[model samples]
Target chain A: MTTFETSVPAIEPTGSLSDSVKIHGLLAEFETPGDILKAAEQVRQAGYRWWDCCTPFPVHGLDRAMGIKPTILPIMVFFAGLTGLIAAFVLQAFTNSSGMSVWAMVWVTGYPYLISGKPLLSIPAFIPVIFELTILFAALTSVFGMLTMNGLPRLNHPLLGNDRFRRATDDRFYIVIEARDPKFFRTRTEAFLESLGAVAVEEVQD
Target chain B: MSSIRADQVGGRIVDNTTEVPGTRAPLVLNMTTFGQVTAQVAKVSEAGRAPLAWYVAFAGSLGLLGLLGVCVLYLIFTGVGVWGLNTPVAWAYDITNFVFWVGIGHAGTLISAILFLFRQKWRTGINRFAEAMTIFAVMCAGIFPGIHVGRVWVVYWLFPLPNQMEMWPQFRSPLLWDVFAVGTYFTVSLLFWYTGLIPDLATLRDRAKGRLQQVAYGLFALGWRGSNRHWHRYERAYLLLAALSTPLVLSVHSVVSFDFAVSQLPGWHTTIFPPYFVAGAIFSGFAMVVTLAVPAREMFGLKNLITLRHLDNMNKVILVTGSMVGYAYSMEFFIAWYSGALYEKFAFVNRAFGQYWWAYLLMVSCNVITPQLFWFKAIRTSIPLMFFLSLVVNVGMWFERFVIIVSSLANDFLPSSWEFFTPTWVDIGTMAGAFGLFFTLFLLFCRFLPMIAMAEVKMVMPAANAHHDEDGHHHGTPAPATGGPS
Candidate 1:
């Protein structure tokens, strides 16, 4: 079979890379959000770009402590909502007022009917659908934009496999600094995390 | 069995206003650590077997849901004539049920969106449950309109789409506005609910012992690592959604009102309909929230989180909204008389003394008179009385829609075509079946997911406000309280 012929050569390259299991990151567990809040400020000052703190809930001032920039999501959502509003108006205006025909499978012509002597292009009447579309677009963007920015729906994360670090979602707070960060040296960073009073620090495997 | 879980409060834990002699009670009772919050909520979902009551309730709900399924099939196969719809009363039970269920969905959004904007930290306890109720109630509401169309397969025609018929949905029509409004509402509510669930799902995913449980929870959890970067954007998105939803909550019911108000029918053609309908929606929605919450918190041993304060607060909302609804009812009659229009006067007068007088009487007595009982602190806090009153309010609300829709349609201007409307067995069964669908979804949500928003709850506790530098916890000794539930 063609499958058997291609498989023999592909295994050789993967076998060479198997022995050196590269480190994904290091996790430093904190007993309290307060503890992590203090350490995050230190880490932020140290200029480690590839690090993130983890908590069970949204911690007040932790973003500032970590020097995280305020998200631009609201600005984007506003524009997305605006697009919905304009699109609704255009769609309604063209279909109900203009003698426009658009092709989808076939040319579908706009058919406007006189009902209760109401005008065909009534903006007042069209407002509800416009308003609803605005909301629909903004809401969809908010959820999807948040997910996209977070790089979520990731099937695996290195720290999820770590036992003690699993408490990040339960009660404990964690700070993980990736090994790929420029300032990251295994010993020095571990010592720095320990000195900042991490209750426990563990290396995470990729 | 009492207000406090007596066994859990070992003097160190503050259970209530009366728990400790010198201190005021905390919002969360008999708890000192974040771990305790996680454990309390997780235990409910992680239980090997649900309590006896769960099985009993689920069986009853599932049975009714089956009734709904059968009724839908029968209606589709046999046609829409299975219901008691006559020529004049064509919009009788179906439209009434649609409005009733849609109105009941309002309270959930009000709590989740409006309360969040107001910075009501106490909403943390019950917002998730209320939002779940909103989604399910909307689902139930959606069914009525979809089936009432008679031709189930052609429901897609409601949307503005390119078709061989060469037609577009009339955007100018309030009915078409309703399709978009309700559809958008369902989509937004689902997104908001799912957004709230991700972190909690991660919590469930982490704690799951069985392989199947782990995989199922993990997949939905989307491999959430509780990263603060994610939470930062997540929180921003939540705020944006809440802000978007606030006006949306108001708009949905208002558009529903437009469905009637845009018409020229005497009783239905009123400018006051939007606010009146929205108030009634909140009234009935709050009542339904209590109707579900009282049993749910008790059944799941979640009394400490969803405490008497939460119930007391919800009853307060019911009382305010109920009084508003009563005022609106009286105002309608006044406006009718003030206008001096013959048909309007007859519509209001006939609504009171017509064939549907019994329905009007039940609405007034239950909605107007029952919520007045919540004025007493003892009554508001009393579990059994509030529970009973909530059910009455729900019944009163359902009848309110029935009277409004049927009475007006029954005695229209073309009096020769008018007729007294009555529900057939199918009509009654389908309405009851909607409740079955609602409860079936809710019971499953409670069983499989974190019924309480544990993450949000922990955000509100006093411990979250601690500043390590100021508190001198800087050297960071492992606080014994920070460990997992002991």
Candidate 2:
């Protein structure tokens, strides 16, 4: 596969923009990694930084093309789990000790079975319930945190409406040169994408 | 299937190479795929006798279940006296079968919830079937205790409610604790299992041939759209439920153990029972998984996903749990001897060399010695051996319950009360019926439902872009293309 090269011009968006800005950027599809890398390098050489690549499966070097970094879900999950443990402990202590007053009063008044010297408030026995609650909370927090951070429950997306995108479920690859990218100008980016060996390029509207 | 290398791609491949066209490999089949259902059904029926064999098995299980139904009706119409549940053996087959079926149900949670929490991917293939097993087994188990109390109509008395019968189920009673534990376990397991099934059900719904099929699968599918948003929330909710379920798995079994351990019965009272019973529950549960999975995998043409690797993993678990159970058995003996209580010593000794020596030997052989063969790679991987050993473990575990319930009660504190507990036709018949109920439901489940979790299998496929190593984000390859013939 020969690498595709393109040039891109910078265009910063204002709080608002002209209706003439309606010229939507398009996506380029590729069938191989060499094609993507060569196209990315050519686009860089062309001074355009407005393109993205999508595939049915994540390509190993796709991040380099996009300049993305690792996420912090693991660290967030760690702290969330830690918080769950602390919450469980505090909840148990407050509920068992201070909240036992009514139970203590009722028992002392009406039902007193004298056994040996086991205390009425046994913290040790309550540890099992507390441990279970801690794991329960930690698991819930981490999972929910993952969902929220990932932006879930979105029933629809503009991407889903595209017929060509159907292959995303089975086998296909695509890269969109968004107009919002810093070095995006429709004509220049389109020219750059053409040089990058995109089989077909079609504009995606907002 | 042909393998395409990056070198074969036109020019230097792009940064993310696309799919090589016309190379979708056929799905693999094995023990984990169809086992008793598809695989065995595939083999025995291959001589063109499978339909006949299925008919025979179905008819046999149905007849046995019918007999069991008769036995149950007889017991309810007459009394508990239909079984040989005399004074010393009051617990008899009802309690034994109760514990037996509950133990059988344990594998479902172990395979699904526990394994999922551990991030074991192989669980996807087997968890569906195991969860179904858990539900049916629990159904069988729940029946025994419900009718064990003579007035079967008032079994609701165990429920904690304010009513005309103005009495509360004693919170202190282990039996009440059992009610809560079993009920909670069943509900939670059912929810977890069904939640996992929603997406798969949608797959089935879309492919159903008729309206009734559509409605049945559609209702259960809950309108799953396979959208990123639904998946995101579904994943989160599933994880939360799984987390909730993990402790419940341990607590539920521990509570069941307490049913015996909390009792003043000399052999029953032991601190080790909780973990011991839990391990044994898992042991027998895994055994059942293997017994069912091996055949299901083969029959269903799911060998690739449910691969030999999965079978090896399950075998290893069985060996570990089997050993743990063996250790518990020894510990009980040591504690009995060290305590120097005559009753305890007698309970321990009589268990090994007494009149019920056959039961003791069966327990040791099945739960302890039988699983040891798994130390050999051949035995672990060999389908036939695993199936036979699973039966051994099942029979062994049943005897373990028998030895515990009968031996301890038949010759307890008073010698005059000693009597050999014998199971009458009703006792044997009801047990057969429970098996019938279990198989009948299982056979029906297999006929419907995606026997394999199609979406989950696709997720784990090497080509499915489920994981992004750089960003730690898994948009997951779009939902897999469905309706492929096996």
Candidate 3:
């Protein structure tokens, strides 16, 4: 019976830094994947750890050039799946197996009943529920793990302000070295990117 | 020209002009550059409006959806008695429809998950389309079971939540397993589908001209910037999810089969039901995909992207799975006669020659006999013939469920309860309306979203700009040595 409206504040590009808007990074556009890969290798060798290459699709070997390490998501999923399997077994056993309990008087939480002369705690019957829960937990872990690792749901990023940077998802590739990086200098980074055959270099404001 | 020996062609270095023996057809036809792949797919979504045929189809689907809504409301007001369910045949059309729709949902996961694990690149072209179909088919499947409970408002009792009565769901019941299996299947499927759609949504967001489109597509894109670091982790997560989904696909249908196999009924109790049902599910699911893709590719002018090769591959799958289903049918009869139980023997015999003989004959003709035509290359390659055969498979699959449910239940072991079962108008109306719901959702998807996976199709193209050598000299060119081996 209620509705809520959440709107993202519009990003305005003024080409100047103000209190509310500071230089977030320098974005360089490359016309080809090879050019971007060459530039990324240079950036990595130049010891810029906070830089990344963006492409329309996953450029093979670009991860090696950018020096990104493998993720630990598979381990997280495995543990989450194990937790689900154990939890399902415990839940079923507690709910279906009758045992004496100490309350004000002796009572039983589980009212066990027999069907087709099977045992009260049937592991065979419990297997399906366990399997389903395992998958459910593992799947949930992977999706949420991905989102958290990617720092998503922030709803806003400074790179989105630049119109030319939008081509990162379309037909162009980019290399952006954040302003927060230790080795980054606006003019020097722009010059380096240009030396690596960047067609355009622009500043991203926060 | 008279007789060029193998040694004459540079000794095992064959010329480019000569055709190689037993070489497979190219997965992607009309090899184009990366930018062209983007432009071709993006143009469909970027077009200001859909074509006239799309509008016409959408309108027709909406009309059927409205009819479905009416039938559902009427069914809710009146009870399950409005269906043709009687003493012996209580699970007639509703259960049949539920099983049929659920079976139809299996092919999407098979293509997206199983084929991906095997490194089949051809699946990239049509995986998105099939996955969407799976979601919609599951939606239709969920409806039948939800409404069949009669007291729809109390359906939450299916879950094992704490209540004032202090009673829990019977953990021993396969029906309860159905709840969790299908529930998890739907959730994971939706997550997988949305995850795959994110990059494409980002592409749509960047290309959007209007402010509203930008905000909507941007919200779903979740600020995806195509960073190499993100893609690295994203690819790992995608593969892990695919591995998880592969087993989920087998488990979901196996649990559905458990709904029957676990029971003590004469015809329903069998060990073969799990694999038989899974094979049938993929068979029907592929049929539904072909039924949809043929018209969609033609109408959207996507012949180059979804080529004849894709259709041929799908037909091959249908051929294999259809044969598996046929084998299961014969094995069921042989086992029934070999069991030495009078009830089981009569169950098999009555299915083919008893009161519901027509349903059995139709199921056999449509499912087992019709699909064997795909063995001919000419029949498989012809567009119109494949489309018609796909529809026939659909009809046959529906009757297969009908025969399994109705024929078994129409005559029990007790002679006192033997009777005939028939459907009421409401049964027929509701079944037709489910199609209305399916097509309505599918048409909306076609109109609004990118039907084909654009980013994926680009990855498979010849000119996607990958570095093949350490020197980085080799880029976006086919390797010369690739023709030497398989």
Rank by lDDT, highest first. 1, 3, 2
| Predicted candidate 3 versus true structure: per-residue lDDT over B414-451, tens digit per residue | 98998788899899989999999999999888877888
How far in Å is the alpha carbon of B168 misplaced in model 2? 1.4
Query: If scored against the real structure, what TM-score would every candidate get?
Result: 0.93, 0.69, 0.90
* RMSD in Å for all candidates: 6.4, 10.6, 7.8
Worst 10 residues of 2 chain B by lDDT: B477-486
Q: Write the per-residue lDDT of candidate 1 for residues B1-486, one digit (tens) a residue.
A: 012232345345532423455433456877767889999999999999999999999999999999999889999999999999988788988999999999989988899889999998779899999999999999999999999999999999998788877778888889999998899988988888889989999999999999999999999999898888899999999999999999999999999999999999999999999999999999999999999999999899998899888888899999999999999999999999999999999999999998889999999999999999999988998999999999999999999999889999999998798898878889989988988999999999999999999899988766665462253433433222211101
* Model 3 interface CAPRI class: acceptable
The sequence of per-residue lDDT tens digits that candidate 2 reaches over residues B1-486 is: 242322233233321212347653222332222112222322321233334445666788889889878999999999988889888778978888888889889989888888889988678767888899899888999999988998999898886443543234444446766876787678767776776776566555544556786677667665554433234345556766776778788887787788889788878888998999889888888888888777766665456556676777788999999999999999999999999998899888988888899989989999999988989987887878888999999899888888888888887888898888888999999988999999888766765655565555544443333231234542322222221110
Candidate 1, residues A45-70, lDDT tens digits: the string is 77787888989998877777776777
Worst 10 residues of 1 chain B by lDDT: B477-486
User: Measured against the native two-chain assembly using Cα atoms, what DockQ does each of the candidate structures obtain, in the order listed?
Assistant: 0.41, 0.05, 0.33
Model 2 chain A: weakest 10-residue lDDT segment is A106-115
Fraction of true contacts retained by every candidate, in order, equals 0.73, 0.02, 0.60
- lDDT-better candidate, 2 vs 3: 3
Q: Write the per-residue lDDT of candidate 3 for residues A24-108, one digit (tens) a residue.
A: 7889998776788778777877777677788888887677666676688999999999999998897788778675343313343
